[model samples]
Structure formats: C-alpha cells, structure tokens
Target: MLSKVITIAQQKGGTGKTTLAVHLALAFVKYHNLKVVIIDTDPQGSLGKWFMVRSKKNSLNKNLTFKTASLWGAQYESKTFKKDHDIIIIDTPPKIESDARPSIEAADLVLIPMTPSHVDFWATEAIIEIAKKAQKKVLVQINRANQRSKLINKTHEYINSIKVSATNIIIGNRQIYPSSMGEGKTAVEKQKKSKAVEEIKKLSEQILLELK
Candidate 1:
C-alpha cells in the first residue's frame, strides 16, 4: 500500500515542528508496529540529529527507520518510495522557500504546529493559505499551551473562524520534551504522565483514525 505522507510545517521557527515529527514517528512505530520513516526536509536538520543520537547510542528501534533528505529529495522519493513504507513523516523548514513548496505539495496531510500567541496566529494564515493552495488536508496543533491562559481558547476560535481544522489535542509546555530529546528518548517513554506525552499520543491516534 502507498504510505500516508504527513508534512509538519510552520513558517515561523521554534514552534516544535521537528519535535512533533520525531515523537509522532516513534509513536507509530512503537504503538502500532508500523514501519515509519522520517524525512528530514528541514535545513536545520534537527530531526536528523535526533536520529543520529539514537543510532550512535544503539537506541534506535528496529521497527523505526529514518532517512534525511531535502525537499527535492522528498519529491523524488515520494514518486518511488510511497509503496514501500507504511507512513512517511516529513519535517519541513521554517520558511516559505522554494524547497518547502514541493514537500507541501507532496503531502497527504499538512500539520501546522504553533503556540498560542498573536505572532504565531498571524503567521499561520500564510501557512494555511499555502496548504489550501496545494489542496491538502491541513490541521493545526496548538503547541506549548498553558492551562491557565485564555490564549488557547482565543487561538482556537481564531483558527476555527478561518476554517482550519484545529486538533482537540493541546500539548502543554514541558521540560521533559527537550530533556528527552537531549537523551535521545521519546517523550512518551521519558515522562509517562506529562501532559505533553498524553497530548501527542492523542494527536497521533487522531491522525491514524483520520487516515483510516
């Protein structure tokens, strides 16, 4: 079967795009026993580094396979590699560059991760417009939410008004995520009860359900 390709993108940087991509890829491999692959399309290559760390420590799971490639590489592979894997998650760059366009175009689903802030909200419009132009399924994931803040509700309303699908999952700010990445471990295994892990797992399940 052809793999479901999901591209995690945000024009604005530091929005947890790579983090979500890495964790979600691992989640699918661990929980569902699916052959998951991650394409590090980002120029920063944060996702590539995470995989490198896992490989060096011999902590990488046999079920999870990842490769680093540019956006052009993704397009080339999409045409040929879709049938070999169960899922391919692409970690896109944080700019509306020439490379990002093709990855977005090749995606079956485009997940835009952002925090609950005015700057992120404003930047989302451009990303959403690009995804819409590509005619892909676009969903917004609210990252780094604070339970006591009203920004989450406001951002949800704003995105809904703009007719974007906002996920019911809200990943809160947690130190365990960064810490787990530093140790080359998935957040779900590092901080089992943290809100971050719960939210990401829910989001992953939702994505799987949607794909089915």
Candidate 2:
C-alpha cells in the first residue's frame, strides 16, 4: 500500500510544529499499530534528536523508523518509505523557502500548526499559498491553545474569517508535551489522564478521516 504523507509545517518557528509531528507519530505507532516512518527535514534537527532519544529507550514499535534528510532528498525518501511503512510523517523546516517546499510538495496533506496570535495567524497565508501553488491540500491545527481563554475564542473567530479548513480538535498548552518529548515518550504514555493526550488522539482521528 502507498503510504499517506502528512507534512507538519508552519512558516513561523515555535508554533508547536515539531510537537504535533512527534505526538502524531507516536499515536499512530502505539494506538493504531501502524508502521510509521518519520522524515526530519528541519535544519535544526530537533525531530531527529527526539527520535534519537526515543531510540535510546525500548521502542514501542519495532517497525516504526525515523531518518533525517535535506529537502532535496525528502522527495526520494517520501516515495521510498511508503513501500515499507503504513504512513510517512515529514517534519519540515520553519519557513516557506526551498527547504520546506520539497516536503510540502511530496505531502498528501500538509498540516499547518499555528498558535493563536496575530503574527502566527497571519503567517499562515504564505504557507497556505505555497500549498495551494503546489496543488496540495492544507489542514490547520490549533496548537498551544486553551479553550476557555478569551484569546482562544478570538482565535476561533480569526480562523472563521479565513477561508481555509481546520481540525475541530484544539491542542491546549500543556507541559506534558515538552516533558514527555524529553523522555522520548508521548502524552499518551507520560500523562495518560491529561487533556493533551486526548487532543492528540482527537486530531489524529480527524487526520485519519482526511487521509481517507
């Protein structure tokens, strides 16, 4: 079966882009029992670092694998990994430059993770336009969100003002993400009762539907 490519991307840095990628990869591996492959295209190598840490521990899934590559090599890896894995998640760079384009173009779906702020909200236009130009679909995911906050509600209004589609789930601001990632574990394993785990699982449900 051809693997579904989901590229988590954002033009601005620190929008929980890598967090979303890591959580989703873990969820797919632990919950869905799918063989997932992660391609880290970020120059900072954060995703690869996380995978390395996870590698130190006993991996939950023997079939799940991760590797790093430049944007130039991502296209080849995207095509190559699908033959052996059920899904391929590419963590692209934090810009819309050539480094991010290759992964976005190879994506079956590009996830735009943005925090609720004027700068973060507005930055979506560039990446959205880039995805559109690539003739690919874009899905928005609200990251570092708090549902009860006025800013969160206002951000909802902001999203409504835009014409793009987004996931119904909200990834609330929580410490479990960073803490769990540090130990190479996901929210599901580290903070089982926390809302953060629910948010990740909920987002993946919508993502799974979109992939179908």
lDDT digits (tens) for residues 1-212 of candidate 1 = 53888888888899989889888987787777788878887777777788788788788676676777878788777656687888888888887644577888888999999899989988778878888988889999998888779998898889989999988888888887798898777897676576777777888899988776
lDDT of 2 at 2: 38
- List candidate 2 stretches off by more than 4 Å: none
Q: Candidate 1 — which pairs collide?
A: none
What C-alpha lDDT values do all the predictions have? 0.83, 0.83
C-alpha root-mean-square deviation, each candidate: 1.5, 1.5
lDDT of 2 by residue, 84-122 (tens): 788899888876665677888889998999898889988
Q: Write down the TM-score of every candidate.
A: 0.94, 0.94
